[model samples]
Target: MSRFEEELKRDKFVCSECSRCKKIVWPPSNYCNKCLNETTWREISRKGKLVEYSYNKGECFGIVEFESQIRIVGTVKGSERPDVGQIMNLEKCDYDGDEIFIFSSTVQRNGSQNS
Candidate 1:
């Protein structure tokens, strides 16, 4: 498995950052997509913002954006409905042939419960 997949299996969210240009490499790679330099792995922040969302069979799913760059689709876990653009925290992650991400909202950065 790739480093990214391995990290996911351990419930750690990580991405490759270019050592030369310091750019975050999405679709995590060993080389920078911009500068073609070798990359080092780094943990991504747990906090993200909800970008968009949908429901399937009453399960909430949404696209969450992190570091103003990386965007990932994950299942949103909560009893109440989630608001768009609300702050979200990565709750769980794993890999099993495919990646799995789970998120839950705590509070907005501005201290509001929802946004």
Candidate 2:
């Protein structure tokens, strides 16, 4: 299959479609935080804009705004540029856990340059 198709077929197993807001939780609901009328196992657009980022000591953390949803913490791809506030695509990374996301190669928009 093509690379794009392969990406679409990638299994995002950890994502539980627990519709707590809908009062129908897949993993069982104790509290509904998102408060959406309904929640479904939908694939994220894979595209996002870097909203905030920080690097302390030797660790790095970034927040990406994916569509209408709030920002999510993400790991930058080793192959891609690690600049803060740069828009990128979410690609599966080879790291611990079920799946990891990385920034795409090309930057769609530029943020404030850091020293």
lDDT comparing candidate 2 with the true structure: 0.50
Best of the candidates, TM-score: 1
Clash totals for all models, in order? 0, 0
**TM-score, prediction 1:** 0.89
lDDT of 1 by residue, 1-115 (tens): 9989999999999999999998889999889999999999999998999999999999999999999989999999987889999889999999999999999987654864744
Model 2 over residues 8-109: C-alpha lDDT tens digits?
A: 356332222336544333332233445644445444556677776666555555777765354666665553336655665666543343334555534434
Q: In order, what lDDT does every prediction score?
A: 0.92, 0.50
Where does candidate 2 stray beyond 4 Å?
Answer: 1-36, 57-59, 78-85, 93-99, 108-115
Which residue pairs show collisions in model 2?
none
Candidate 1, residue 21: CA error in Å? Answer: 2.0
Residue 73 CA error for candidate 2 (Å)? Answer: 0.5
* Superposition error at 31 for model 1 (Å): 1.2
